[model samples]
Structure formats: C-alpha cells, structure tokens
Target: MKLINLISPSANLAELTALASDDDLLLLRQDAVYLVYQAALPFPGKVLALESDINWRNITLPAHIRAITDAEWVTLSANASQNLLWS
Candidate 1:
C-alpha cells in the first residue's frame, strides 16, 4: 500500500527519513523546511512547502521542493502544514 506521511511540527526529518523508503511519500512541514535544502534521499516522492511560510523566504530550497500556497494545501490532504518551534 502507498503511504502518505504528514510531517508537521514535533517531527524529526532525520528520523522520518530513516523510516521512510523509496516508496513512501515524505511531506515536509514546519521546521521540516530544513530538509528542502539538504540532499534528497532515495525516497521517490515530492517535498512540498507552504508558499506563505517565512521559511520559503529565508531558505534556498532545491528545485525538487515545491513551495505551495496555504489554499493549495487546504484543498488537498495530500499537503501538510506545521508550526515552527522556538526554544
């Protein structure tokens, strides 16, 4: 079965990446924005981000990482969003 992983706040990309396989679709959100700039794993899925998010302006993400708007994500559960942590 195809899996759709919604990675929001409180989720670690590294840990998720480890668990994720080439078949799994990893959806990055919130602090997970950092993953966009990093190297792409063997996982053959799309890495999406929110266009209105501040991270989109601060980070230089790879082409593979698509920056979508809030409305877009809202329309499809296929997309996910999250809040960044600050401590």
Candidate 2:
C-alpha cells in the first residue's frame, strides 16, 4: 500500500528515515520543517513540507524540498492508502 507519513516533530527524522520504506511518502510539518536546512533529507521516498507551516515559521525553504498547500495536503491524505503520523 502507498503510505503517507506526517512527521511534525523536530526530532526523530533519523530514526524515521531508517524505518521508512520506499512506498512511504514523508511530509514534514511544524518544527520538522527546520530539517530542510540540515543534513536530514529524509530520503528513500518523496519528502515534502507544508507551505503554511513554513510561512508561519518564516523559514527560507531550501530548493531541494518542495512545499505543499493545505488543500494539496488534504489531497495527498485522501490519495494515500494508509497514513502514518509521527509527531
């Protein structure tokens, strides 16, 4: 199944990255957006950030990570077969 993982906490990226499978889609939100600047790329799958959260944080997003809208977030949630929330 295609899984969409919502990771909102600043910590746990490394552990989650190691645990995540290729079919998982990881979307980092809240404090997790800060990982874009660090070495925490959350690779092995599609890694995205919530644009609203990024704007609220006033963070300058790196070119590598794509930001998704609230509507898009809902769409992604609806499209996924299952969801894994890691906060």
Each model's lDDT comes to 0.53, 0.76
Question: Candidate 2's residue-wise lDDT over 32-55, tens digit each?
Answer: 777777765756887888999899
Query: TM-score winner among the candidates?
Result: 2
Q: Where does candidate 2 stray beyond 4 Å?
A: 1-10
| Model 1 agreement with the true structure over 1-87: per-residue lDDT tens digits | 133434444455456556555544454556656556556643455556666553645876677777766776655444333222221
Worst 10 residues of 1 by lDDT: 78-87
Cand. 1 Cα-lDDT? 0.53
Please list the residue runs of candidate 1 whose C-alpha ends up more than 4 Å from where it truly belongs after superposition.
1-25, 54-57, 78-87
TM-score of 1: 0.55
